[model samples]
Target: MKLTTSKGARALVLVALVATVGACGLPRSGPNKREIFAGSVLKQGDAYVVTVNSRVTRATAVMPAFGFGSSFRNAGVVGSDTINAGDLLALTVFENVKDDPLLGNTGQRVSLLDQVQVDGQGYIFVPYAGKVKAAGQTPDGLRQILTKKLDSQTPDPQITVQRLAGDGQTVSVSGAVTGQGVYPIERPTRTLSTMLAKSGGIAIEPAVAIVRVTRGGQTGKVWLQDLYENPGLDIALRGGDQIVVERDQRAFTALGATGAQSLVPFESQTLSAIEAIAQVGGLATSLADPTGVFVFRNEPAEIANSVLGRKDLRGDQRMVYVLDLTQPTGMFEARDFLIRDGDTVYVTEAPFVQWTKTIGAITGTAGAADSLASVGSSGG
Candidate 1:
């Protein structure tokens, strides 16, 4: 019985060995060596060029009126010597006015009125007409006031008042518009858009793209885009008001195991980790080791010294973040983690996978050789 049992055991062992050898000889179902090789080469790195949508919001284009003919009409205080301040006036009192020698034949050029400056004050400086305040008064208004003042001294004293330089008017233009400098307030009805066009419009790619008006120390942000949407928003600009155009500076980068890795432009001003991942075409399913996904960033040396020595990092030396996505929640954190410019992302390959593939290849080759030998023997 022992001999029979041992023979049976030997036979069983032989059968098991034969089954193992036959199984090895059969073609494997998964991707072939050539296919895997091709896949490995093709999927090795991320694509260099990637398409990103532009952030600028498109609006309806409107044809603006062009040429000097469309320019604003010159009105309100046009002449250079129209009016000014601090000029002496002459108030002349003609006794027997019609018979006065100064009123000779023609009364047009007669010295009928005279006023003069006194005590450094803006008043008609007359011989006996002390200081009369003419600061806030216009030419006509000053004329009347001087007439009253001289009349008090001498009844019906003809008076004329002219300004030296009209209160030094000026307008300030600033913000995103070009040529941000003070412009002379030539007209009181200058439109905001006209001034902007004169100053070469707003800077390109402004952060805010909205012009802010600061007048009398009050601030307000106005959308330049709105001007096209609603024409009324392009109101007339006033003196001492500033127009500021804010610049936009929000961006993110895509790297690592994605199909296309590039700097993706975002206008939302804030880039979420999830959005960034989608921007780069997501991770490679077959090759990417989801567990080994990592983002490298700079941190303070003092804080990182506990986990990694200061010598590990170079210059302005700092910390390095090592993230392992093996845990289920790690992916969630990665989705939440904000990516900045110049950030490096790495996706590692699965461990021991290459070894298994190598062994499988060796076994396949041995099986093919054995099968060929068996066929040769049969043919012989």
Candidate 2:
């Protein structure tokens, strides 16, 4: 019985072989059996605009609001004189009031006293009070000083001294902005955002905007994104403050069996595996093997060297992780995976798929040739 069964199997195998050969006879010209599959792998030299997320640590702590009358706002005062020698005074005096005899004189009826400018040499020129010192004083302070100086000569003198230059204060604006320059600050306190606007705001590409402040030789870096996301991060600006807006620096490559394989920019420091895949235009349906998708990454050289010396390698080095999208649980790990720059993503094709494609192509070509020959014979 065993011998009979063996013989029967051999006969069946021979018959199957003969049927196959007879059905598809050997052609005069060899068949093009090269498998043609969909999808293209990504290669180097591809350009992509990568978004970079930069975390800028504050070089200096958030400075407390300077109290009123701080040195930063110190200004020279001008005396009650028309000569160019007095403190630089910033005072708002009343002048040009309606003439009234009860107030004082008809032409000088308690007019509004406007603030006047004083030179650095501690001298201010007044119409009637000659030159006076006006450095190191506010508008009110300068007004009192001028009144006393003029009263000694003339009682109830109609005079006023105000600051023409705003405390002689200026602030610098730099970094990623349309216009970066020094702007005269009239107010004592200004917000970081306001200063940025004065300097034409952040640059066009502000994914990694950094606003830096340097005051009294102290420097601080603030994230523009943080300021936008959290309004509390926006700090105040002081006179003589230097602001800098820096761009970000971090990127990644997108490739393999996906539409538009290019470098994708991300402002976020780390990119989820799903996000990276989406940036490359998702996976190709015809050629991507969902279960065989893999991201190849190399460990840092220093770490690799250390591991080599110890003969203990970490999984990240020389390790190929197979991502099985078919399994529901795999989605969690896929989402958690972080893509780094220079990473290579490979989407493999199914085995035996090439064989089917080659067979199909050959069958199609043969059918076309046979139909052409039959038509020729009928025409003859």
Candidate 3:
């Protein structure tokens, strides 16, 4: 067929072709295929890529391992079991004073005692003794010592001793708790689990909760679930220790052709690569490359050395890990591989997705020409 078209009609066809090219969702900087950090990984040579087996075996070796409740259990206040410099004491003294009319009415005996704050010198003044050492002594021991010293001052002396306030036997529980205050430990129940229960237990995300115990300027952290599962980790709490229960937002960033591309939080404390992939809505069906799933993380020097199998790394401390989901063993490998906090899961686009889009755009552009051709032929 001999085809001739007016300038206006040709211009309309050209405009329609342009519109079709623009509508098919061509790849761009923000397209699902455009990975967020792929450029940086290419530019920076420090990123190391590892497979499922290497990632699971070597990368896990260097993570910082921490134990909780040591401060609570082995705390000096808990183990010492005695009065300290800051402790408060309440004492009562009874004496038989016959013919003592000034000592309260017709009573032949008199009793007197008062609260005494332990001084910086670790001593408290008694009725007769000028200064008696009270720190480091148990209430019973102090009672005996006071009873002996008052022997000459009061006849048939009876002395009672009680701790008015035990600042050393109390712990502070805060963060993600129903009650944020000080809790006293009076018995042997100084375990962290028990102490947490005494303070109304933990709140926020218990499954992924981080329980941080601070004592004497040193702090240690353990998962709340770890304490529940491991009895040994539920170590006793110590006096003056501080406990903080906070939700672990163990989050990872998802990019590339994944169903969701954003910061995603792991539902639980322990997470495998497969679980993390699924949690981020899985990879996009058409655009995702099953063979190109990658996880980017900042590996410690030790971990990086182990992963690269060298004493020195060629790139930065950052490392890259890839999993080929196309293989039959990929799913199981991912199950064994763990995801760390602040990891980036990138799912690259399949080669065919771009071809399919390009072909679709061509057909769309052709369709516009065909429609215009039909109109021109009918008019002829």
- Index of the highest-TM-score prediction: 3
User: Highest lDDT, which number?
Assistant: 3
How does model 3 score by TM-score?
0.77
Candidate 3 on 203-307: residue-level lDDT in tens? 777777888988788888888888888877776666677899988766888888877888988788667888887997887886788888888788777667776
Full candidate order by lDDT, most accurate first: 3, 2, 1
**Candidate 2 — worst ten consecutive residues by lDDT sum?**
52-61
TM-score order, best first, reads 3, 2, 1
Model 1: per-residue lDDT, tens digit, 167-188?
3334566766778776643343
Candidate 3, which segments miss by more than 4 Å at Cα?
Answer: 1-3, 6-25, 28-50, 54-62, 68-81, 85-88, 101-116, 188-191, 235-239, 300-305, 308-318, 359-380
lDDT of each: 0.47, 0.52, 0.73
lDDT of 2 by residue, 277-359 (tens): 77677777765556656665555434343423444543444423346677765666567666665666555554444555556
Better of 1 and 2 by TM-score: 2
Model 1 weakest lDDT span, ten residues long = 51-60
Model 2 alpha-carbon miss at residue 215, Å: 5.0
TM-score for each candidate, following the candidate numbering: 0.35, 0.52, 0.77
Q: In terms of TM-score, which candidate is stronger, 1 or 3?
A: 3
- lDDT for residue 197 in candidate 1, whole number 0-100: 70
